[model samples]
Target chain A: MQPKRLSVLGVGLLGGSLGLAVKSVASDCRVIGYGHRRATLDAALALGAIDEGYDDPAAAVRDADLVVLCTPVSLLGEMLDRIAPFLADRAVVTDVGSTKASIVRLSEERHPGIRFVGSHPMAGSEKRGVQFAQSDLFRNAVCITTPTDATDREALEAVEGFWRGLGMRLKRCSPAEHDRLICDVSHLPHAIAAALVTMQEDAALDLVGKGFLDATRIAGGDGGLWRDIFLDNRQNLAAAIGRLRTSLDDLERLLTPESSEALRDWLDRAAERRQAALKP
Target chain B: MQPKRLSVLGVGLLGGSLGLAVKSVASDCRVIGYGHRRATLDAALALGAIDEGYDDPAAAVRDADLVVLCTPVSLLGEMLDRIAPFLADRAVVTDVGSTKASIVRLSEERHPGIRFVGSHPMAGSEKRGVQFAQSDLFRNAVCITTPTDATDREALEAVEGFWRGLGMRLKRCSPAEHDRLICDVSHLPHAIAAALVTMQEDAALDLVGKGFLDATRIAGGDGGLWRDIFLDNRQNLAAAIGRLRTSLDDLERLLTPESSEALRDWLDRAAERRQAALKP
Candidate 1:
């Protein structure tokens, strides 16, 4: 059941880190990488994240036991379309996409010859580059595998087994559910952090400290990538955004210009729940 | 003016940390502590945060050259009122209060018989209690001093020099300005972090990963304390909250569900800003 060759389709932070992590536990797993930019492929190879690099993605996936799409969310369908003919039968294709449902749907419908399993490792630093890749990045983190009606059980197990070998805990969920949960806790929080930072009226930001630094830290993340994600999971994101908006509205109502006793009460409750969640 | 004796009015996290921090730098400062509860005072002394514990307010402050109030924001003024008469005439007094204007006003109006300076150290951890107290916690953090018209130059200089010796970047501002700036950056974000965690629809949050944990980390902070802070600085917090509301509204407009491309563009801008800022 060992993968003879693993092709990392995009040699960015996620792809490079996955390759590095896989190499950490499995000494025999030979890694090959392909990226649109030659610099990234070279960088991944120089970083020792991959054993080899190829400009031609078709050639990269020609003999891989596992092929992973690690490009930006917007590039997934087209990447699948181009690689469809090159993919060997039963050579399971997977993705590290933030959104699952759309990626699963696109690969299932577009690339009939290849098996597609959707994967998302909930790990990575704020930095996004091949140079930021680390073997221990996914250590103790959860990597979700979302399989659909068209997904092969053997492919799902193989991807899950690979993730587990990388020292990650595997959690199986439906594509829609992954999108919903991640949107609620991850994607929506990023958008909210950005909006919150942009909302500050303090133009003279000389007084900012660690609290502002921590709260708005996520706001400074990649927006184009996030936008693709937000749009891809519009239904879930819209709901999450709505709930956050309502909470803001309620807080606003409590904190008018003149009176604000209620604001303290709400803050107290929010603080309590937030603290309680951290206790285990 | 070398202080022969120092009294810490509360034996909790801040009080104990202050005692320990000061004792490390000034060996002659006989640090004594007092708390309403006997257990807290005992714990502070047991942990070497103070040399001795006292039950009576007057007994704690009687002969001390410096007295510090480090209780809850709501309790500072009350504690000052109780210990005002026992303060040594030239004994410099200060309170580590988050909101400054009210505390400054209280010091000016109530503690005229003794010297009072309002100070705030921009450092804390989610951990609470005397057990969590550690010396050198304030190292390399900003410690703000808010002085009123009645503040003596020598007393201000003394406290400024004290904090500077401890490796804190000292800043001087009016109490109102201090509260406002903190609201815009520190307190406001803490409130938002708290609210966002509670507002999250992702129930059964045992699955939340590093992003959610990091993003909402401050939310799990002390609720009652935050409540007191919000109420104490109601006006400034209200303004800060207003600014956040407007920003969220703009984000909502940009994310109108009907326009997919527009949403993507907005997300693109946010991501770009985020990426640009994360560079160190």
Candidate 2:
């Protein structure tokens, strides 16, 4: 299941970190990175994130046994298309896109023979660029693999094994399920964080404390990246927002003195749930 | 304006921390604490958070030059009532309540001639009790003082000086302004975090990452404490929620391909604002 040659498309934070992480686990594996910008390729090279760099996605995957598409959600399909013709025989392809259904569907429809598995490493920071990449970025983090009936069993196992080798805990689900569940955990939170920041008065922002800062920390991520996620997963995200609004509506009803006990219960339930979900 | 004797009327996390912080700076000052539970009082005393402990709030304030009400928001007015008749003449009184308008107004009207200033020291963690008290809990944190027209100038100055002495950056405004602004930054965020946690499906909770945890960390606070804050500041919180909903509405509109650029702009604006507010 070990990848002998790994090709990472887009040498940004996640891609560059993937390169470094792969090299750390499989020292004998050759890591090749692709980026449109020469400066990014040079930075990835200097940082030892990749042993070889290519300006062309096709060139990067020419001999790679494993190809990881690390571009933004909007560019994932295009990247898949660009590398579909050049992927080596028995190559198992995957991606680190936030959303899954659209990318997975696109690969299944347009690139029939490509052994592609949709992966979401669920690891990253607000900080961007190859300079911020770390070999341990995916260590102990959840890496979800979305597989469909059309997915190859051997390719899926190889992808899962590759992520586990890089120190990730793996979870498997359908692409639709991945999008729906992740919308609640990831997309909705990002949108809410942004909305929370946008709704603040200048005076309030001045008086913000650690709580507010932490609550809005996700809003500090790159805009273009999140824009693509929100747009791609708009339906599920919109539905999650509706559910959140319903929760807030319930809270509004409990904001009265008569509902004091109910309000405490509501807050306590949330607190207990979040506490239970904390990593031990 | 350091007090010769300070009475802390709750002996909980904030109260004990205040005592420890004050003792660090004013070694000669006598610290008295009040708590219903003898065990908590003993814990506070054993930890050197207080020089003395009392079960009676009135007895706790006896002969004290300064009194800080650290009880829950719902009990603040009652604490003031019990201690109003026993306070030493010219003793400056303050509180560490999250909301200011109701408490400030109540103090101004119900306890006429009492030197009271509404203070919200923006400190403390989700962890409660005297065992979690830290001497530097308030260091570099913002302490907001809400002064009404009827507030005694000397008492306000004493309260502000007390917080500043504990190494807090100080800000002052009218009680209404304090409540309104804090509703956006503190109360609203807590409410939203709780709602975010509540709306999540159990499946989604399993996939949550650091961002989701950080965005909802404030929801892990004590439920009863937050219930009081939400009820006390319901008016402002409701308004803040309405504004947040409006922001979400804008996001919904921008979740289309036609508004893709606008969506990125919206997210970018939030990211920029959050980045600009980062502590240096």
Q: What Cα-based lDDT does every candidate model obtain?
A: 0.78, 0.92
The Cα error of candidate 2 at residue B43, in Å, is 1.5
lDDT of 1 by residue, B1-280 (tens): 4467988888878888888888888887899898888999889888889998998888999888778788889898888899987778778888788889988898788767668889998777766789989898778778889988899888888878777776778888999889988887777777677667767653426456777777777776676677778778877877887777777666666664466677666656655554443332
The superposed Cα distance between candidate 2 and the true structure at residue B151, in angstroms, equals 1.8
| Steric clash pairs (candidate 2) | none
Residue-by-residue lDDT tens digits, candidate 1, A60-88: 88878899888988898888887788887
Q: Give the per-residue Cα lDDT of candidate 1 at A221.
A: 61
In the order shown, the candidates' DockQ scores are: 0.46, 0.89
Runs in model 2 deviating more than 4 A are none
Which regions of candidate 1 are displaced past 4 Å? A201-204, A250-280, B202-204, B256-280
TM-score of each: 0.92, 0.97
Q: What is the alpha-carbon lDDT of model 2 when measured against the actual structure?
A: 0.92
